[model samples]
Target: MPFIEDFNNNHPTFIKNLLKKSPGLTQREVLLCMYLKFNYSNREICELMNISNSTVDSYRHRARKKMKLKRTDSIFSYLNQL
Candidate 1:
């Protein structure tokens, strides 16, 4: 997978768009997305966020819904906007 080496910090801006469109994602969820979009592997995300793997999964699910990111295949799309 080569770790999807390209990185971007345009997360908050993209999330801002999501917030505008959905008007439902909470500030906590947004922060979680920003974390995932930036750094933290799944395990680390869970540990740092004091949540379980499934909770992280739930965050991802909700994030995709809020952002209208229909497919995980295109995840880097958010990063590219940086």
Candidate 2:
């Protein structure tokens, strides 16, 4: 996964540290959140993860819920702040 390599290239331990703190997020959700943090679109994420569009949306929804974000807040925006 080149994007995973890209993510690691930039953030290093950020994702790893976050995963340690976020017990509610599953592995897929954590990876989705990391991709979202990097400002990748859902379509791109779907392609990278080899999942469907709806599946990407579902992961985003679940990740946002786990993070307790408001519906109006952008998940990527919130993630970037962290």
Candidate 3:
């Protein structure tokens, strides 16, 4: 399955680390992380998640912050741990 393929290729350590750092993120924030890391845009995320554009944006920001990722940092740095 595509999900399995994606999961296998990407390490979960980054997400795990982020989750450990920020335990207050809602389910929506967690889902946003999965979608974003998998290369989904906010619009696509909204459609797939059945949520609003604003909600996706908000969740993305919250997820990144919850993960302790600096705003000035590139998203690629987060993937390096994999």
Using lDDT as the measure, the top candidate is: 2
What does candidate 3's lDDT look like per residue over 1-82, in tens digits? Answer: 4753576466546556656767887867766666666787878878888989988777777667766788897554564443
Compared with the true structure, the alpha-carbon lDDT of candidate 1 equals 0.63
Q: How do the residues 1-82 of candidate 2 rate in per-residue lDDT, one tens digit apiece? A: 7877888889887676666656689989989888778778888989888999999989888887887889898776666766
User: Candidate order by lDDT, highest to lowest?
Assistant: 2, 3, 1
Give me the candidate number with maximum TM-score: 2
Error of 2 at 80 (Å): 0.9
Model 2 scores a TM of 0.81
Badly placed stretches (over 4 Å) of model 1 are 1-18, 79-82
Question: 30, model 3: CA deviation in Å?
Answer: 0.7
Q: With candidate 3 superimposed using the best TM-score fit, by how many Å does residue 44's alpha carbon deviate from the native? A: 1.2
TM-score of each: 0.64, 0.81, 0.66
**TM-score between candidate 3 and the true structure:** 0.66
Model 2 spans > 4 angstroms off: none
lDDT of 1 at 14: 67
Worst 10 residues of 2 by lDDT: 14-23
